[model samples]
Target chain A: MSEIVDWVAVDWGTSNLRAWGIGPNGAVTFKKTSPKGMGKLAREEFPAALDELLDNVAPARSGPLDVLICGMAGARQGWLEAPYLEAPTDLRGLLDGAVRPTMPDPRIAPAILPGVCQKAGADNVMRGEETQLLGLAALTPGFSGVVCMPGTHSKWAQLSGTRIEQFSTAMTGEMFEVLRTHSVLRHSLTGDLDGPGRAEGFAAGAAAGLDHPEQLLGTLFQVRAGSLLSGRQPDWCAGYLSGLLVGTEIGSNRHLIGDQPVPLIGSPALSALYAQVLAMAGARGEPMDATAIVLAGLKAARSFAA
Target chain B: MSEIVDWVAVDWGTSNLRAWGIGPNGAVTFKKTSPKGMGKLAREEFPAALDELLDNVAPARSGPLDVLICGMAGARQGWLEAPYLEAPTDLRGLLDGAVRPTMPDPRIAPAILPGVCQKAGADNVMRGEETQLLGLAALTPGFSGVVCMPGTHSKWAQLSGTRIEQFSTAMTGEMFEVLRTHSVLRHSLTGDLDGPGRAEGFAAGAAAGLDHPEQLLGTLFQVRAGSLLSGRQPDWCAGYLSGLLVGTEIGSNRHLIGDQPVPLIGSPALSALYAQVLAMAGARGEPMDATAIVLAGLKAARSFAA
Candidate 1:
């Protein structure tokens, strides 16, 4: 097939790098991914890793091919430092602060977009999520309301139309992992949270977290206590823990959410869980596909640059 | 220099075994500690570990010497299971539930005291803290107040005279360890919290936790954000975490504390921190020496048996 590649869209995160080849018609002609993310690469290794991924993929060109990148690639320790653009920032203007790193391959022209930062109360920052937000904005133009992007470090962003007014980060997922693996709660928690008992436990935990977030320290020990006293299963314990953390996150940030339905941008499974918990808290969670939003975000940024 | 031993008092926990040689006149003639706690010993290994620690200390006798033990030695997986006594339990009656484990040496007749359990509310259990509570009760003959025992798993007990009304456990220390070693917050945390910045951070965290315990999920990330934005030192982050957890613990269980001073039974440094935080929460922390209370408790129990 004789294809004329117009541009490339790359999501260079901490642990993974994904790229999609865009044709002149703005359609994805080819897609590829690698584990050589910003976390594994030094500043000197970025160009080679990019070249390796795009070597046979990019069409023969007389000049450098334009590549638009987002995420940790623009972090201080990534391929090149693309300083954060402080909020309230317009999603369309993300490409304005894009930094161009020196490339070894003359046929590669990469522009890394800057992440978002909140300089006010409880200062916060996000790299890749900014693009995800941009993608969400692209999918729903002039999007307004709270956007929850759940992950290892879950981000809660307040959006006024297409501009991010402010944002907050919660260490819920990370906290859950640490407690489940390294704390005494590990004794009572095992296996994945897939059972019915886990689901019920999750709901109960979410309720407890919402009702008594201050009681987190006391409630956590209940995993072991319940196991010893009532012979509660490991799955239930895991579910309860998940519910508690998610519930606490939602409860703590409920003030940020208005009457508008909260849009959760993340993996389907995680977003579903968040949705379930949000429903329990008398709120709505609209699950949005992460990949779709990310691609849309990169495409929007590309068009804005052009 | 010849001495006659009356009985042995032991605090045999999960990680360490501490014993005191009681003289005929109720004085501590010898004190020793070992890492051969219940966690390190199998059912058969317990006799040998105890013998090693008790060697050349017991008086020459054909009959087994009476040895009173407390803590994890009475757990289900310990030498012999000394089942838990449900609350509301009388401190003086702890010996009634003591179980004697079979020993290899005829000269070692060890009796393990049962820990207390609360089957109500959130379902709680404690092995060593019961003994500590007994010690606290012995120190204050008619003690009627909330007792705070801080450690790996901190316990807060409501005591009326010699009876334990109810108790709650918080995995504060364990949570701290997990967050510091395994969580993403570890990146912004390190070293002992001793600097001025750390103290300020600790106070601020404690206040935040006490004032708005619901904000824990959001507040935890502030440690990292502050570190990234304002160059917050590692010690400050550690101190802030410690304060937040401790403060939340106190804030959550504030209903347990009346107008009376809260007796804090633990080590000096930990007790001091708790005391400071308690003062911030508008409660007084009366620091009580742990060893003194434990010895007093054992002595009282010994006399009761006689």
Candidate 2:
């Protein structure tokens, strides 16, 4: 496995690190993942963590393996700060800002991709998602529109062809999780964010959220009040809360989204949920395979690192 | 002191239990508090917790002390559900729906006041704040205006004279605390919420929030992005976050607020903060003492129990 491997395309995030071994023929030879994310590791430990994860994958590489990394691994607190490539730039511009971190293991050659930043109007930044957007542009040449990447900090990016003009981030996902687990609503909500979450509950909540996004403060309380006064179930309460946050996010940004079919690049369950919420607003959320897009992104970065 | 205490006015909440011993003259004779709030105590433990707090205040008593309890003690998961008194009702009517818990100690005559609920258009509920609103009504005779109570869960009520026609709860305070401590913004913010949290930061953030509260999901992320791009200080980030949330809460409900002075019933610091944010949106927030108000509410509640 080590002898055949040419390079590794890595997506290193705050809490997880995933990698794909690329063969000399430009096809994936192996796939691997590790819990050694950037969040828990110190600057000095990144090289070792990468080496350990790689050692498990291929221990006998004839030459140093080139590693092209994206995401939080390039954060200020990551292995080494990869300065942001200001937005309204082409995905191809990412390679110019790509930084190479000194590695302790001679068998590993590391290059961490720079994140995208929008410094002017609404102070905003993105780390790993920029690469995914780059991948989207690479897979679909001249792709232009809004791309929604949902996660702890869901991002909404505007791209003109292969160039990103502007982007914004919504803390909706994090808010939903915190309120569900830490606020008074926690008492009314039970169950995890796994599976479909709660379709009926989400639809009802999404309706409320979409109707009056400005009335979010009051509507949030409705989640708790619904359970207390109306005997709403735990799952329904959870779904309602989820829908409310998502609806608020989409509703707030819909003006910029227009009526175009937005590309949702994330997990199947989450993308499907976003797609459903999009239809409620008369738009379509086109799902893109996250792995395929990210891999394509890493592959694109390979050209710069190689 | 127990001999002089004719009754006890108690405000029991999720994390704290506070009692005011009332003398025969209808004045607070002594004050005492305990960590045995409804959130930590069980149904059977409420009686003992009340006894311990009362014992610390006044050990020797001649007869059974009439105890009037309000807040979470009457919640569904409380010592006993006092059942929410559906809204469009007067403060005096709260006494009519009060329920007495079966206490083992005959020395303590406990009556838990019911909360208020709005089941129509926007489902909303309030515990403890109802009594404070009652206090406001009692303190300001012929009061007919909106009251903003800031705390863990801030409540905004439309009061016509002594009756609460409608009310809504905003998870602003809880949301602020959670995002500051648990979310990505936590990494950017440092320092306790004590003292006047950065004034300059608040003024700026409040303006942004007031301008476009619909962008709350995005404005929240700026707390981190500001620190990252603009090198914002920790205290500034904290105040900015605080201001953004407070502004959003007030801004979202501004249409109903008009340009009138809202009577703010809560802690001095919190009330001042809300007052500042309200002023930003051209509305005045008149600060009222929380203790005097709640005690007044409980004192008024005493008449019904007696």
Candidate 3:
């Protein structure tokens, strides 16, 4: 029932995996997603997980069809460990160190793209986002600017032409999730997130985070205290905390970001939040379609066929 | 047997409760502890929990014996909500609005001291630490300076004579714990914390936190990356992270602390660590015995009894 496909492009992350079928004519058609990601599967279980997803929509070809994978699936503890490609190198070098995993089925060929790492200054690493960055580089020729990818571990990169000069990561998303779910602040952040006083609270928090980041740790308890002593609503508290964290991420890297617009490669909802914070700090955000960029990155890797 | 026992002082915190038996002569003779605290018991279960603890070391009395209490037991969610007393007031006023809970046992007389709140500039609140600050005042007459108490929710308070002018709370301990146990940093923070490279790692992290607080969120990823790419020891990561958080806490409040030697109150180990960080910041920390001060504060509260 599927159209003719030459290869499958997969973005396998810690929590989930998304796949796209690519035709030889550079057209992307078939699509599938599974919650089973690298985090869920062990070394031995990966083959079956991959096979299950591939068999669902893979076109029947006389020869073994190629499968290109990016993200945490290439992590050290994932399907197969792909060594990190050091930073300052153009992402085109990503395919040179890609790992080819031996599959049980003779009809499947898979290659895992290596993640990028920065050892000097501040040690940092990134996997799937590198592919997205590559896609950004591919989409806009000679693009030179700062890019922000918001996620569990929000990443910021400085790209000069095709080479990534340096990068840093903020524990913004992960910190927010953990603090909301596990900390005392959890008590004050319970209600419909989109309901009541949210905009005011987010604005107040974002301003504080962006202006006086030195007071970041000191002001966190105010989220709970405001709710308790001042009767600040739960929605307001949640929004405020989210804005505070996101704003802090942007503020901390404002020097690298400059006044120039930043390309935000992330989910629509999260990217919009970062865009809001950036605008507040005199900078702007240019929203790039995440799916389109990542697919482009995968297709770029496909061209280096053996 | 406790000699001439007259009343008992208890510090019932979130996770544990500690009791000190005081004689009519004002001598603290018996000390007992239990893991059951305000966090574990429901509203109805508080009485039984308190009864179980008091039933053990509480002295025999012909009439109802007074049980002086402070800390989370007086929290809105604790045994009984002792409403917070707004700041800029002497902590000796802690006893004025202390709640007297009607106990199940006729022989038990309980009074829970109210916590302090700063509602104007920054919404802030503290439960048991108010009593600790009261004790500090009682120990040093006319003591007017800053006090740093390290714990799950680290607190810093400014004292003018006996009055607590203002205070702030940091989620340092809680943040470190959650990140270590729940975040990706958990993978690299294993092995003995006292094993090796502890001091060097801590120093480096402390410097980073003290000199550049805005880089806090950006540099956290380095803890994990260091271990992965740079062969950082687990002890180093643990020590580094610990220093980073503690240093950030002190660095953020450096202006409030000024050139004055801050009083360090809490566990000896934790207080000593804070002292070390303070020393690095060109200030000094004076270690105050927590038990001695709490006993004095509770004894001070006991004087208000009818």
Candidate 4:
């Protein structure tokens, strides 16, 4: 049976699903996304959703569908639990398989690779950031420093020459949400601190966090009690909290990173926030459009197949 | 009629209300407390509840009542809104004056004294802790150094040569409640972390918080994902969160505290936890019973009249 696509590269995570149709030349012919995030959907329903995405970008071609996927889909509850590839392994060895589900002749997108950790006392694993890193490295030539990928779990990766150095993840974004939306501190934190987090609130939060890395939790409570008992504005308290988390992340990673220029591949707003924070921490950063990096990453992976 | 008792002293806060009866000799003839905490009563009903506490204890005295009070009863919503006494001001100056509610006979209970803060760029206010500090000073002669008071709003007060030099409040305990019981992190944290936070699981969490303060939120997500994917225990996650807040408190106070020994005042269990944390942070600490401090404070305030 003839299939319709050459290669498809997909990036799926907790909240969103994205895919790109690629020609042999590494050019994207179509790109599509859906709200069916891995966090919301069941494993059995993933194939139907993926097929709908492909059908929207369906074209008349006579070839087998070749697809590469990554992200939470490689997680345990994901479509197919892609095993982790240890640190230092780039894109090639990490590919799970060319998945083809029964619902459509168009292949079910293959699960991208995940990272493994066997170190004593550390059993953490990651699935999507590695693919993003590959895409990021492919986009920027001679890019060797820290690749700051900010999200629910912000990652700080050290790329030494061509080999990936050590990396660490900070739950800065998620913690910010918990503090602002769910925690008792929420009463004191009013409105978005600034511009999808690029505001002075974010920068201030980042700076404060770095300077007073130890008081993150203790200082947060002062927001509620201070505001209620003393009439402090809710917004300032919010900004103060943002400062704690962002500042801590910047401080923790500042020493481990290099003076060499780096690339940021994630939401533009979050990427900007990270850059602003890095500057405050004495680290200079140049913004790399996350979309460009994702596309470039697909190309880099395609080069291996060719 | 010869006045049998000159006045009364009451310490009222969120969860407890306590009062002391004094004779002309400054000797406490009677003492009583009730669960009439500010948290349990309505704003309009404060006077009645306070009256009930006094009524319960006043019967022991031979004559009229002269009462001096402190804690939340001095706040805006308190009895008569006794304004705060600035730093270096003794109990006499901080007193806003006595209030005589309609139901009472001896017609006089001195107002509570409030805490004052002058730290620039930070909201400064005090409530019940000031009274506790005053109480501590009266009880302990020539005592100086830091006082670590543990509760929902934990305080670290700097005592120098019979005066409170400076103080900072940490929201450690409150944050612990929110993270463990309220936020999304609640899913990852279940059951109590063994023995009122003495279990090894809690210790491990504290260590994680100390080692990676920024990874707090990210690690918390693992509480949900870990259980969903690989069956990680939820209670351990709760303990880990406890450690983060406690660790942050220890870290924030590191520089400001410079080798001053910590005198902790709380329950045996909480004192033990604080001591454990202080040890982890390399700070020296000794537990001091709160009951002793309260008694000493009452005696000291009485001596001022002598």
Candidate 5:
């Protein structure tokens, strides 16, 4: 028959909404995803969206159901503002900063976890990734080193045991998107990073970004110029743009890695790309499955709840 | 009686069309601009757009009007492909590479000037800016040193007398536009460069970019983090972004400038911004009027044509 839902774990980002139903044994019993992300929903619409997702799998309980969420859903403009928790924070206590939203359904108790913010030297923040970090800590007990989460906003964190000592964010994915779609470089890019010359282009771009990061502004224009002058194919241009941004991100944050192999947490494809670039930069990357980490993180966070 | 038009100088770019009526005495008799740019018009629509703009001001000439055009109008997909004049070439002969398009109205003899292209090292291209370089050469009479043209794609050219030895293009302005509009950093930006804390923010960003050009990808996220953590104002974030991009561009291209006073060419406001950054970098920026340079460049180009 149906497995009883112990709690629900949600990763609500700007462009997507994902929910996982956990069994009492801490195993994920059900998982669902929707395009109705935090970006798409208004404050009031959030409850209905969550309800729709949970309707089929939520266990019929007499009291309130525990729904734990991370990501943009906790941002200032999301369902309810969960002010950021400053960095140098212990991952074990991430759920302590979780704020509960006033819900119309008394049966649903939604607790949104606050993102981690870096206030010193370089200002930075991460919402959903903190959960993943917690999961990482659980998966590898007493883990200490740098963690790279590659995506639209790639985050690099320095962990001291179970505590995140510092972190930085790079708008690498967003920059690639905007340059690919909105800028003049659009004419030169084919949008297929796997096409011919892509690997070579990516390698070249990454090297350039790593060696001379200051030349990024100048380097970006080469995509269009290479097309016009050297007949550089569109796919290669796309690959080069990706490589350049990724390389720059890795190159700039090398200090955080400190000669240690970086733990890359993301989708396989994205993590592989980062791994490739990381290798080129004279470093190694340890890839980890993002979903597993998030589930583990959610389970850990749920254990601390009231 | 309407003033007779000897020839017309047109700067047709991706976003706007500007034309100046030049009399036989080489003086601008009339000037007008339109939203009908090269990007907006199809190949067949170009003649009509030109005719509409030329109407009521063609001087009722019996023969075809001589139209000297520069910019994207000479692009491969423009009215007709004008091809490109490979650089390390003299600016005086820019008209020699001009191509005449087939027109419905024989009354319109449009000779589109070719842009400059660099095939070596990092591939680079410039369309309308070649005219400005030509104009700069004409206005200064054997002007040398590096010339900086700030725009959507900022161009930096090393000119020895009338010949452009080498040049580079930076996607600074385009980067700023995309980051400001499409990225998450948008929330932190006010779209105002003159707001409180703007000057300090700009100076700080420029210094950071100059100091650690490699840190650009990491540096950009500070806008959002600063806003979330320190309540950084939107305007200050905008200024910081602008400064960071500009400083990165300047720092990377320092080799092109070589301790020479750089000539800044563009609208006063934009040139002034570049000037401020240049001053910060210990380089003097000599601002020149873009209109005068374009007119001069066009006149020089016309002098070479039959």
Candidate 6:
């Protein structure tokens, strides 16, 4: 087992396949990724892809290797279906089990665990982000704040003493796409602009939305008419639209999280964007290094198993 | 004045200018248009653009000209600033008056009137489309129904007797543009579809939204997660997304005009699209002839003035 030993942690997602190899000391020695995302691969193809990566990291005689996996790859559509855990769960209870790709050698991957969610009258489920959250909790002891992970559908997970209390997902980014590119507002703004801090228009939009969300559809028309009739700049209107979405999300979830500061996990650009908007709403937030958090989660799992 | 009359109506809008010369009996003698749409011209350039078009059709040397102008050119940003009229107004009362460039001969151009919207304490306003509604009313008497003019912003207006009783605008089309081009959702969708009719994924999206709006954001993450995990088809997801926006519009406005047949005033493609949706919701509808409606509004104004 020692001869075949190497770092093995999987970032298995629906469309992305990523795995890393680390030394015994928890240092990443090498990493590999492939197109064999969970969504594309057939059920039978799972073990082969894992082997393709493991084959590079451990090429010696056959021996057992410690492995860990996370993400949607542990989902129903993944190689080994992992059932969801309810919210307020510890690390082990949050997951079902990891999958071992059926290999000819019968030496397959370890089981992955799924994330948990809890909402009355709603079907709540999460997969990979939970590990990141666990990693986050490991890195920052006694962090009872909001962990916001931004994406196509951004999730705001509330944690209370290492247990995920509750969470909500907002479609602001997706709605932004719908409004900017596919909708009529495209004619008003030609391209995108980036400012270091939150855009003024975004702030205005959020404030307007917080004031009256019911008038959202009607107010958007004024963006075009305002430009056509009053020479309102299109770029500003774009920013305003962004504010509306971010503001709306905050308005919906603000009460749920209380006045706790938010810890953002994601890429730099996304975290910065969220921080800017949160600041405008008078909410406090800090950027947490996602890679560090993911590794911390892995180390915690290793320690748990040990 | 009667003998020289060729086209009696001129519709000047942003980006393009159109004029119709009529015979003595009001039959169309000639029709012409210029690239001088409101989009291309600055505020000061309006008079010159108007003069160029007049030089061709109603030259002073030819005869006395009776022309009516409408569209964005009459907006606050255009050459002649036409104040909007309040709702429940007749064509004559909505008239903002016409303008003739002082440079050319003393020619007369009738200004088109804007429609009005008064929402409680909100200010009232109107524009060129109201004229088209008026024209439509003249052509079809006792016209008491809703007119849906689809464009950047889709406007729905109720015409009672000869007055435009009430109106509302939806940013549905604009939202479509934003989502398709600007947001991360843009990445999830295939650039363009082969044809106009609903795609397969569209139905799924519609059902999803109509059945579960709360799950929208969470489900959208599947687009990215699915691609990451399972290599989900982007094209089908794109269609599904289109359905969500279209479905949301239908769902939100169901209360205002529930299952009622309304007249569609727009392009054939727009008409067909709306018809498909309305059909799904068990609502009846017919396409309003756009050219006829606009001209009818012009004729109605003439008759009302005479």
Q: Quick one: best lDDT, which candidate?
A: 3
Clashes of 6: 63
TM-score of chain B of 5: 0.94
Question: What stretches of model 6 exceed 4 Å from their correct place?
Answer: A1-130, A136-153, A156-216, A223-243, A247-298, A301-306, B1-7, B43-63, B86-92, B97-105, B108-112, B115-127, B195-198, B208-238
The lDDT values for all models are: 0.85, 0.85, 0.86, 0.63, 0.85, 0.65
lDDT tens readout by residue for model 2, A1-306: 343577888999999999888887888888888999998999899988888778755423477778889999999988999989888787777777889888876768888889999987578999989899888888888777889998779999998766889999999889998888788788888655333547788999999888788878779989888987887778888889999999999899888776668999989988998999999999999999999999998777656433
lDDT, model 5: 0.85
Q: Tens-digit lDDT track for model 3 on B111-143? A: 899999988759999998988898898889888
- Report the C-alpha lDDT of model 5 over A122-156, residue by residue, as the tens digit: 78888899889988888888788999999988888
Q: In model 4 chain B, where is the ten-residue run with the lowest total lDDT?
A: B92-101
Ranking by TM-score: 1, 3, 2, 5, 4, 6
lDDT of 1: 0.85
- Residue A250 of model 5: what lDDT? 87
Clashing pairs in 5: B64-B107, B190-B234
Clashing pairs in 3: none
Expressed as tens digits, the lDDT of each residue in B198-251 for candidate 5 is 888888888877777778888988888888888788878887888888888888
Error of 2 at B183 (Å): 1.3
Candidate 5: which stretches are off by over 4 Å? A32-35, A53-64, A105-107, A190-194, A302-306, B23-25, B52-65, B104-108, B190-197, B304-306
Q: Write the per-residue lDDT of candidate 2 for residues B177-291, one digit (tens) a residue.
A: 8888788899888765333547878888888888888889988899899989988888888888888888888888888786568999988999999999998888899999898
Q: So what's the TM-score on candidate 2?
A: 0.92
For the predicted complex of model 6, DockQ is 0.21
Model 3 regions more than 4 Å off: A56-64, A302-306, B1-3, B48-64, B304-306
